[model samples]
Target chain A: MSDLDLLKYTCGRTDLSLICDLIDPGSSVLDLGCGDGLFLRYLKERKNVRSLGLEISAEKIASCIANGVPVIQGDLDSRMEFAADGDFDYVILSRTLQEVRHPENLLDEIVRVGKQAIVSFINFGYFEYRFELFFCGRMPRGRHLPYEWFNTPNIHLGTLTDFHTLCRERHIRIVSAEPLGRIHGILPKWCWPNLFAHSCVFVLEKEK
Target chain B: MLLIEPQNYDFGPGEENALELDCRKKLYEVTLRYETCGKLNADRSNAVLIEHALSGDAHVTGYHTPEDRKPGWWAEMVGPGKAIDTDRYFVICSNILGGCSGSTGPRSIDPATGKPYNMNFPVITIADMVRAQKRLIDHLGISKLLAVVGGSMGGMQVLQWMIDYPDSVAAAVPIATTAQNSAQNIAFNWVGREAIISDPKFDGGNYDPENPPGKGLSTARMLAHITYLSDETMGRKFGRNLQENDHYAFDFRRDFAVESYLQHQGRRFVERFDANSYCYITRAIDYFDLADRTNGDLAAAFHSAKGKFLVVSFSSDWLFPTKQARALVKALLANHLETNFCEIQSGYGHDAFLLEIDTLGAMVGAFLANTLNEVSSGKQRGAQS
Candidate 1:
C-alpha cells in the first residue's frame, strides 16, 4: 500500500479528518502526542502547512523521522515553556487531553502558544456510557473507552459539559464544538449534544 | 574514488587578526588544516560544515592516497548519494583549533619563544574553536552555510556555531552531545588528565617527541574507549573469552579478550595522538557550558539563535545522554526556533554516532533537503513579492 493508504489504515481516526479540515494552508502547527506524525504528514502533504510534532514514544518518533516529519520527544504534561507565546497558528491535541496529568494547564499552554487549539476527546457522558453505568454499575467500557479502569490511560476523562465549563472558567472562547456520534446514531443538529454526542472536537481560542 | 588533498588556511598573524583564547590570552600565527568535498554552487548556499569529535580530524571522507588501507573516518556518511551527499552539497571538515591533526595546538611553535607552545598554549573553549572556523569560513568567501553538523565534542562546536553566528547557518545537527559538561563527564576527563600528568615521561607537558608518555596516554585512551561502548556491546564484542587460549592464563598477563582489545586501542591511539594536545582539547571540553554567560538559563542563552535544528542522541550514550539532547531541544524551542530531535536506538553507546549511519544518515539527508527547500522557496517568494 502507498503511504497515504497505510496512514489511513493505521491512523484514520474519525476526528483526524475533522482536525485536518479545520487547519488552513500555509499556517504553522504543533501536534501534541502526535502518533507516527500521520496527521501532520497528511496536513503537510495536502494543506502545505509548516508543521512539527511532540511524541513521547521513541519507536513512533523513529517512524516520524524516517518519513521526514519533524518531531521532538517530550511529555505533554510538563510545561511547554519551550514554545514562545503564539508561536504556532494551531496546536492540536487529538483524543489525548484526558490522558495528560494536567489537562487544564495543557489547555492553557495550548491556547497561549497557538492562536487556536483543535482538541478532540471522547465524551464520558454519552448516552451509551451513562446507560452502562446506570444499569451495569461498572466503569464504562466500549469501542472508544476500551480499557478497564486499572489499565486505562484516560484518567481525566470528561463529558462535553465538563469541557465547556472548563473552557468558560479558563476564559477561552470555544469558536465551535463539533459533535460526532459514530457508534450510537446520526447526531441531531444541536439537540442535547452533551448526551447524544459520543465524541467531540472543539476549536478554541484564547480570550483577547 | 576521488582523492582529497588537505589544505591549510593561515591567519591570526597581525594584531587585528590575533585569535583570542577563552583564557584571556591572544595567540598569533594560527593555522587551520581542512579538506573539502564536492562543489560549491554559484550562490554558495550548498556548503555544509562537518565538525569532528574529540579525536576526529579534517579527513571526513575519501582517500588521501589510493594505497591507504582505510578511507576518511566518515566515509560511510559523506560520499556521493550518501547522507550529507557530496553530490548535492559542498562539504567542509576542518581540524579544530586545539586538535592535534595539523591544527595549531600545543605542538605548534610559539613565535615569541621560537619553541613549541606546550603548556603555554592557551586553554580554548568550544566557542573559540568555532570562532577560528568562522575565520576560515570568511576566507572561503561563503556568507552563509547550509548546515553545520557534528557528533560528541564536534556536536558542541555545531551548537556554538549556531549561537555564535546565528545568521550564517541555515541549519545545525548536533549529535550525541550535551549543552554543558556534566559532573560525571568532568570526572572521567579528570582521570584521563591525571594519568597523562602523573606519567614520569610527561615532563611537565614537555615530553620528548621520539618517545612520548605512551603508558599514561594509552591508559587514558583505554578508559575513554570504555565510555564510548556499553555493557551490552562489550559483552557482545568481547565478553570474558580468553585471548588466544581456551583457558585462563591464571595470571595478570592479559587473559581476557576485552583487556587485549583495550590495550590495542590504547596503543593505536598513542601512535597518532599527541598527549599534550589531548590534555588541552579535553580541558576545553571540560570548560564548555553554553548557559554559563546567561546565569545558567539555557533558554536565555539561545535567544538570538535563528535556524532549523536537528538534535540527535543514542539510546545507550550515557556520556551525553538523551536527557541532555532534550534540554538543548527545549532551549531551542523556547526561542521558537525550528527544532527536530530524535534518540536513536542503538547498543553502540556514545560511539553510535559513527556506527549507526543508516538511521542517522537518513535523518540528516532529509533535514538538509528540507532546509534547502525552505530556503530556496523563501527566496523565491521574496523575489516575487
Candidate 2:
C-alpha cells in the first residue's frame, strides 16, 4: 500500500494523536500487531523513537522492513522470544487486544517487557453495538467494528469496565484512559463513553 | 583528492607515546595513533580510517603482535586488491579509545590519580568514541576523509562519524548495524556484563592486575560469539559433527569442534583484550541511540551529510540483520540523500561483510572508483574555471 493509505489505516485520527503524546523521542518501543508498521515508522521518523514491531503477517513484516522499521513475524499467542525483560519503555497493543486468544497472558508479557503498556480496542458495550445486539438481534458492524461476525478475528469482545476490571485484577494500574468517538471532538471528557463511544484507549503501568 | 599506490610507503613503526590533540569539548585530550600503508601528503584526501569491530585492534591487515604467527583479523579484506583496496587508499586503523591496544584503555594508568581507570572510567557513548577519532584525524592534519568504514561496532562508529561531523567525510559505509540497539541486544549485553561482574575474580570490575578476570571475560566472549554466527552457517560448518570421533565424549572436554573453536577464540581473546575495555565498549554500544542524538529524527541526522553512502548488509547477519540496514537506507532516502544498498546473500552471518571476499571487494571497489572519478572530474572542471 502507499504510505498515505497505510498511515490512514494504521493511525486513523485518534490513535496517532494518542501515540504521539504517549511515546517519547528516543524511547525503545515495541508495537504488537503493528499493522503495516505505519505508526512505528511515523514515530521513528518524527520522534526518533527506536521501534520494533511484532506482527503475524509476513506481508506486513515485509512492508515494515522495506520501510526500515524492524519487525519480527510471530504469533502473539506464543511467548515473545525476541525481547527480554524490561527491554522497551512502552509496548503498544493498538486495535489488537480483542483479537488474541489469551489477552491476559499477552498483557502479562507486555508488562514484563515494557515499563508501560498502551491498549486500544473497540468497546463492545458501546450504545450502537448494544442496541444492534438487543433490538436488531445481529452483531454490530460499523466504522469501528468493521468486520462481519462470521469472519471477524476479534474473539474476546470486551467493554471499558471489563478492561478496567481485568487491569485491576492483574494489579496493572491505569495511568490514563480516554473514550473515543465522533462526539469526542466536541466534548472529550463529558462524553460518558463506556456505553456511548466506539472505542476505548488506556495506558497502564505495572506497579513496582 | 590525492590517489596513491597502497604499498608505496610506511607509517613510522617506532613506538611513539600517545599524542594528545585539542578537540573541542565533545572530546578530551585522548591519544591519537595510526599506522599507514601508503604515502602521506598534504591533501590527505586519500586517507581512509578503518574503524574496527568490538574486541578488534589497530592491526588492520597485518600480522598479530607478540605471537606474529597469525595474520590480522581483516587480512582478507584490507590488503592490496581487497575489498578496502589498500593500494589506492592510505588506510589508517587504530584501536578505539576504550580499547586494549597501545591506545589508552581501562588498563592504562590515570596520570592524575596514578591508578588504572578500570570501571571508574567515565561511561562513554558511541559519539565520544567518534570524537576521539575526530581528534586523531585532526592530529594527522587531514581536512576530510575519503570514507569511514567498518562492521558491527566499527559500523556504529561509521554512522556516528557521519552524524557527528557531516562535513568531514566524502562517503560512509556502515555494515551489519542497526539505527539503535534492540531490546534483545540490550539483554545480551546485560548478560555479558552480569557474567563479568559475577565472576569471583571480577572484584566489582576491579580485578588484580597480575590476574585479571579471564574466566568471566572469556564466558562473555563465548556468549557473544554465538550471536555473531547464523544458524544455517553453523549447521553447515559444524552440525552434529563430533570433535574427532563419531561418538560423544560425554564430559565437557571440548567434545564438539565448535566448542574447541569457541574455546580457542575465547582463550586467544583474553590474552590481548582487557575486561574493563569490554565493559566500557559494550556500554557505549548500548547507549548508541541515533535518534537520541539527532533530536529523535532519523532523517534529520542526514540533513547536513553531503556524502554518498553505500550501505551493504548480509542476508544471514542475524546479530545486526539486513532489516536494520534497510532502516538506515529508508532514513537516508527520506532525507533525499545519495545512497546505494545491497543485501548480499551469504550465510557467513554478521562476519559476511568481512568474509564474502569477491562480492564485497567488487562492490566496494566499484563504488569507490565511481565516487572518486566524479570527485576528480569535478576538481578538473574547477581548475579550468
Candidate 3:
C-alpha cells in the first residue's frame, strides 16, 4: 500500500519514516523539537542515520534516555551555537513549525546546520479550517489541530502558501513539497493546493 | 555483599614518579589508591573512569567489609544493574593524589624525614589530581576510556580529563561542576579554611599526635556542609526547630536542630577525614579554572576534545548552578563538540548528584551505551570502507 494509504488506516501519527525516507543511508541528521526521540531512533534503525536530537524539557529528556536516544536538552529559538554550519546531511523540523518562537530565524538556523532540511507543519489555510472560520465563525479545530486557541502550542500558525512566500523572500528554495491528509492526492490541479491540504511537508535547501 | 580491599599503586621512595604541580612544584613519590569493578574487556575499550569529589575515597561501590554495613558512596547507582552498570563496563575509581584515603597526601610519611608530610607536602591543584588519575589509568594498561563520569570536584576532574587527554576518552559526564569556581565558591572555601586554621591546636598544619586539630577540622567540615545544601533544603530538614525542646536555649549550647546537625556532621567528618588534607583539597579546588591555561579562552580548552559530552546540573544546586553548566556547554559548542546538557528539576542543591540516583543513573547509562554502539558501528563502517 502507498504511504498515504497506510497512514489513512493507522490510528496515530506514527509515520515520520516518510521524512526518514528522504535521508540518505549512513548520513548524519539532527531533529529539532525532538519529543521523546522516537523519530530519531526510527531514523537510526531504518536509514543508518547517525542522528542526535535537541529537546527542551527534562521529562522529555528523561524519556529520551529511557529509549536510549542521544538527545540534547536545548531550545530551537536559542542559538544552536553548538552545531556548525553544514554539520548534518539533513535537519528535520517535523510538524514543529507553528510551535517555534521565530519561524524565519529557525529556518535560517536549519539551513545553517544542515546541507538540506525537511519541514512539516499544520496548514492553517486548509479548506476545513477556512470553512470553520467562514461558516461557523470560530477558529478551526480538527484531528491534527487538536488544541484550543488559548492553549495551542501553534503560536505562529500560518498557511503553506505563506511559508512559500517567506522562503522566496529569504532566498531559500523549496526543493520539494507535498500535501497531506484524507483527500490530498485525490485533489486535482487548479483546486487550490494550500486551501485543501490539511498539513504540508517540504524539502528545503539554501540558494547560495 | 563485601568488597575487596582497594589495591594500591605505589610510586615508591622519594619522588620516583614525581608529579608536577600547577603551582610550579613537583610532588615526590606519590601513590594513588584505586579500585576496579568489572573485568577489562579483550579490546580494553570498555574502561570507564569514575573520579570522586572532595572527601570521596577510591571506593565508589560495594562494601569494604561485611561488618562495615555501609556501601561505598555511589553504591546505589553503580552496581551490577545500576546506571553505571559494572557488568558491562570496567569501572575504575581512584583516590586523587592529594587525597588522604590510602593515597599519598599530607598524612603520608615523608620519605626523607620519616614523618608525616603534614604542612611540608607540596601544594596540589585540581589539574594535578587529574594528572595523578591519568597516571593510574596508565598503570592499569588501558590506552583509552569509554567515558569519565564524576560529580563536583570529581566533575572538575572529568572536564580536565576531556581537555587534558582530548583523544583518550570517548565521552564524558560532568555533573554538578563548573569550568571555573565562582567568587562565591572561593568565599565559601575561604570560610571553611579559616575555621580550620584558626584553631589553636592546628599549629600551622603540624599538630600534637594525640590531640590533632579535631575541633578545627570538624568546624571546617561544618562550614563546608552548609555550602553543599540550599537554604530551602536546610529549612526543610531542620528549619528553626530547637533541639529536643520547643523553647529556645539562651546558653551557648547547640540549641537549634540545624546547629546540632552541623556539629554532628563536623564531628563525624574529623573521624574519617584529615584536617591538613581538607586544607589542601579546598585550596586545589579554588585554584581550578580550565580557561586559565588558554588565557581565558574557554573554547580553546575543548578545541582538541574527541569525546562526546553530557553536562548535567541540578535546579537547586546554587553551588554549581545551571548557568555555569550552560556556560560550559557554550564553550563545548563553540569548539563544535557533541555536547548534551540537562538542568534536572531538583531541590537538593549540590548534593543532588549523589542523592538523585534514578535520574543520574539512567542518563549516564544511556549516554554511555549509545556512545559505545555508535563508536563500534563507526569502526565497522571504517573497516568496510
In candidate 2, position B256 carries an lDDT of 87
The count of residue-pair clashes in candidate 2 stands at 3
Backbone clash tally (model 1): 0
Give me the displacement of residue A4 in model 1, in angstroms. Answer: 12
What tens digits encode model 1's per-residue C-alpha lDDT throughout B220-337?
9999999999998999999888889998778888889999999999999999999999998899899899999899999989998888888999999999998899889889877767
* Superior candidate under DockQ, 1 versus 2: 1
Which residue segments of model 1 deviate by more than 4 Å?
Answer: A1-17, A20-28, A36-38, A41-51, A57-69, A75-90, A97-117, A123-176, A182-189, A192-198, A203-208, B245-248, B379-385
Tens digit of per-residue lDDT, candidate 2, span B1-385: 2222122111212324233222222222345445555545345666778888998877777653545666667778776767677777878887787777766667766655777878776677778777777766776787677788888989889988888788787777787787777778888888988888888999977888668888888988988998988898888988878788789877878888888778888887788778888898898898887887579887677776667676778888888887777778767755545555567678989878778867766656665655555454554112111
lDDT of 3 by residue, B180-283 (tens): 98899899888888888998999998886567788888988887888789988998998889988789777899899999999999988988888889989998
Best by DockQ: 3
Task: Tell me how candidate 3 scores on lDDT.
Answer: 0.83
TM-score of each: 0.85, 0.60, 0.88
Model 1 Cα lDDT, one tens digit per residue, A1-208 = 2666846643547677778889999999999998888778888887888888999886677677656678997789888755778989999998999998899999999999999999997899999999999999999999889999999999998999999999999999999888888664436656787888888888999999
Question: What is the per-candidate TM-score for chain B?
Answer: 0.98, 0.88, 0.96
lDDT of 3 at A134: 99
Of 2 and 3, the candidate ahead on lDDT is: 3
Candidate 1 C-alpha error for residue A54, in Å:
0.9
Q: What does the lDDT read for residue B49 in candidate 2?
A: 82
Q: What DockQ does every candidate get?
A: 0.43, 0.02, 0.46
